[model samples]
Target chain A: MTAAALPRTTVDRRPPLGGFSLTYLALEIRRVLRNRRSLFFILIMPAVFFLLFGLPQKGQNIDQANSAAAIAYIMISLAVYGAMTASTATGGAVAVERAQGWSRQLRLTPLRPPAYVATKVLSALSLSLLSVLVEFVVGSIGGVRMPAHVWLLAGLGAWLGSLVFAALGLFVGYLAPAENVMQFMGPILALLALFGGLFVPLEVLPHVMRTIAKFTPVYGVGSIARSPLTHDFSWVAVLNVVGWTAFFGLGAALLFRRDTARV
Target chain B: MRTDTLAASETTGTRTPAVLLRGLTKKFGAVTAVNQLDLRIEPGEVVAFLGPNGAGKTTTIDMMLGLARPTQGSVEVYGLAPTEAINQGRIAAVMQTGGLLKDVSVAEIVRMTASFFANTRPVDEVLERAGIADIADRRVAKCSGGQQQRLRFALALLPDPDLMVLDEPTTGMDVEGRRDFWNAIRTDAQAGRTVLFATHYLEEADAYADRIVLIRKGQVVADGTASEVKALAAGRQVRATLPGADEVRLAALPGVDRAEVRGETVLLHTNDSDGVARYLLTQTTARDLEITSRNLEDAFLALTSGEDTDLEGVSR
Candidate 1:
């Protein structure tokens, strides 16, 4: 066949910069929401943790504050933890897509690499927001109390803080084997949660552990999320978040560059 | 020879060919998957890339599609870099396997892909055109290999691409499935789409491609039309029944390359079966004579199997 024989119905009409298609995002969001396992991890698991740990101590006092304050503190921490997990898991789904050779398929399309990466980050953020919302609802029903300003600021902080873990998830997704990514990320995120004071207060830990926790990315998110109620905002925690976000963001970018260079 | 077809396509104004490869080479540590190869495929021509396993067909295709960077040399699609052509929706591909998400329904996959294209055919239209409309709701994992392939074709059609590259697109299909798949491809090609397909099936190339490019050990050993490639191998066979046939004398006959005896029949492999047939009829007491030209499979084996021959001379 010659060029003259080509069907006139199909012609070149490509737009400049095939980036962030709403339809594509909607489909991806639908796929993620329909995944029962992802839903359980992102929503149910954190709510369960909040109910088990925070409900019993609902009326107790901590740090010279009402028991409600203590419940609110735990609620915020678990919410941040859930957001972080959801974002990281969403990023890690890249491993499965890579294994399925979907990346190669995308290369053949009009979608640019940067656009693809942006879509993934946005999807992760969406899921992270849902995780935070689920924890917030559970906390509200369980009688956890906080000022309106604190709820707004802390929830926003927690959701924004998850960006670091989302970047880390992308890095790990590109670096690790597809089948073992979740297995590899689960324990690693769990350790970060513990050391970052999501499970227990950093003040209760030994001096060395507390010092080390200050450097972990999640410590910054936790501190920032709880600062409104605790009335303490550490510069070190803020710097930790910024520093680790850059670190993981660069790592993910480099890995993505390398991965695309490979056949 | 169908050289006129290749020439006719090349002379069509100032338009760039769909694909061009120059001194393309790919190496993996100590192993070289593709050597210094050059090829130009004009727009609207259907070319079949044929080779044995590990013959660098996939590697070459990868380089052309921008899935892999060449260790040396360069590739261009429609006068632009491959990635640029792809981003412009000038090119699209349907790979052999592993490109589909098995968990998603066929319609979902098509819709997702369509979203990436700036100008796509209607989703239902593409599905129906690819003959997968009935199976659109089926999960990709539940669909048969042929059905999954049709889905891939649907995805490729989303961009309304001018150049379509397929790497063994019908690898795991039944006979009916293969025929159905080719019919769709043929319809697309006849509409003037440029197609480059790599396949192990010689008959598919013979029946569909206007040009056949045979590669061996990372280099093109033969490039021509199907009949031209077939003629490169030992030409044909001349068989006849002659009681107590003398195999040695038969082998010495003009145009005969080798002679063998089976039961009451004498089989002669020849470069010119016409010469052998004429000689058999006039000089020998032969009965039930038959002359058959070699098929593409024979041509493929003959062109690729021999190790000592300098194939570079035959590559054009």
Candidate 2:
């Protein structure tokens, strides 16, 4: 009965959008990084790859291609790997939330849907950066060199790669069946990376594989990422990455809206 | 089952409640989950929504929280829409699934969830209230089911919401854990916060709820307190231990609805237990006679028939 006398806590409806994105980003980072498995997958795997692959690519069959090409492609491949893994994890996380009714929980709370989505985007983007940096340092320590401006291409490639792959993951997270999320992602991403010129140069792949690689998202991301590695700019590769990002970005959002409509 | 007995002042004459609903409905594909649901939850009262599986409890909670757009109705929490109410952090929920991220310490999830609100409760105070102080540093994935449930309770409490909603919150708990969970619920209710509880556990509602609303086939079937519901159970049962030669005699009771003989004992069922008991004692050598009043389950069964069709189909 004394509850009537207790000061009530009213919800603040008009909070400015200040740092809301940061709050979400911070939360996602904390949650994802806290997972030992996620940490290994996100941080350690890329660094290991950089040490393993970044250093050895130069020792492998030598190419007249710019040392920047090798370093850039390594960065691009690592970035794609990072984005793909993060998206897969994030998509799986979203699927789990859907199954467990967590989204419904947020829907009932004061957290906006856009805020939630924005947080996922920022987290994946950041993780991609972290993974890229770790790989970059490993490659540099192993004696790979890039001019300062050449570094910008690596950054752009990594960022665009994150957006494109992260958007694909967002779309899949909403659209995929709850039970099959884990089983489908690894093979699909591996195949894309293998054919789209992440593992082997597109020029070295069989003609059929090269044809199939053109439409895959990896081609877009890999082309831009590999630009510094090769002296030549691959606008088509950049366009492919941008196109896939936009395609999957819009598609995933639409699926999410459709999926949540049932809630 | 009739809700007319609720004092008009308590619901009708009262001001706008903390949570209000007018014919909310949610649908998936062709299947409609919630039907027409008109409810009012005032601050400081605990209201239990009782229903069986697939009765749309989750869907209704979703509409109130603004997770799902009502196909037909509107939900107002803290005088605003569900999503709007959440944005203000005026509302909180203990969802069916624990939203705490696996691999992180429980303390971290609490801190992040608390940051979402402007006037959050202190971290330790909230943690202690949820009985999760000892496990604050443990990774969330390592916690026991009871611990996870308690951790979620802590997260929900961090915001110190005006309107708190729970969806099947005790699904994976043991007896002692359930008691601890109810303790948290009672604490919130005692604080004068409005609580909307959706549970299948009859005892939880029977023991704690100020009012109970029963939904069957997506429609509100009965709305009242436990006593009010039990009062509607008009049927009664009679049992007697008659010494030998009882089968034929018991069948001849004056107002018996059903009669069955098992060895030396005869059992009779009648709406008029007093009349039947009197006859059994006087007309025959029936010893060890016993009579008990009808329980809520009797009333519940009488109220809801199996295979009942859908209820209100309003969209949010």
Which structure among the candidates has the greatest lDDT?
1
**Could you report the Cα RMSD, in angstroms, for every candidate shown?**
3.6, 6.0
For model 2 chain A, where is the 10-residue window of minimal lDDT? A1-10
Local error of candidate 2 at residue B80 (angstroms): 3.8
Deviation in Å, model 1, residue A115 alpha carbon: 1.0
Off by over 4 Å in 1: A1-17, A65-68, A203-208, B1-16, B72-74, B239-268, B275-289, B310-316
* TM-score of every candidate relative to the true structure: 0.89, 0.80
TM-score of 1: 0.89
TM-score of chain A of each: 0.93, 0.86
Q: Name the best candidate (by TM-score).
A: 1
Clash list (residue pairs), candidate 1: A5-B191, A5-B192, A6-B191, A6-B192, A7-B191, A60-A67
lDDT accuracy of residue A72 in candidate 2: 48
Error of 1 at B91 (Å): 1.8
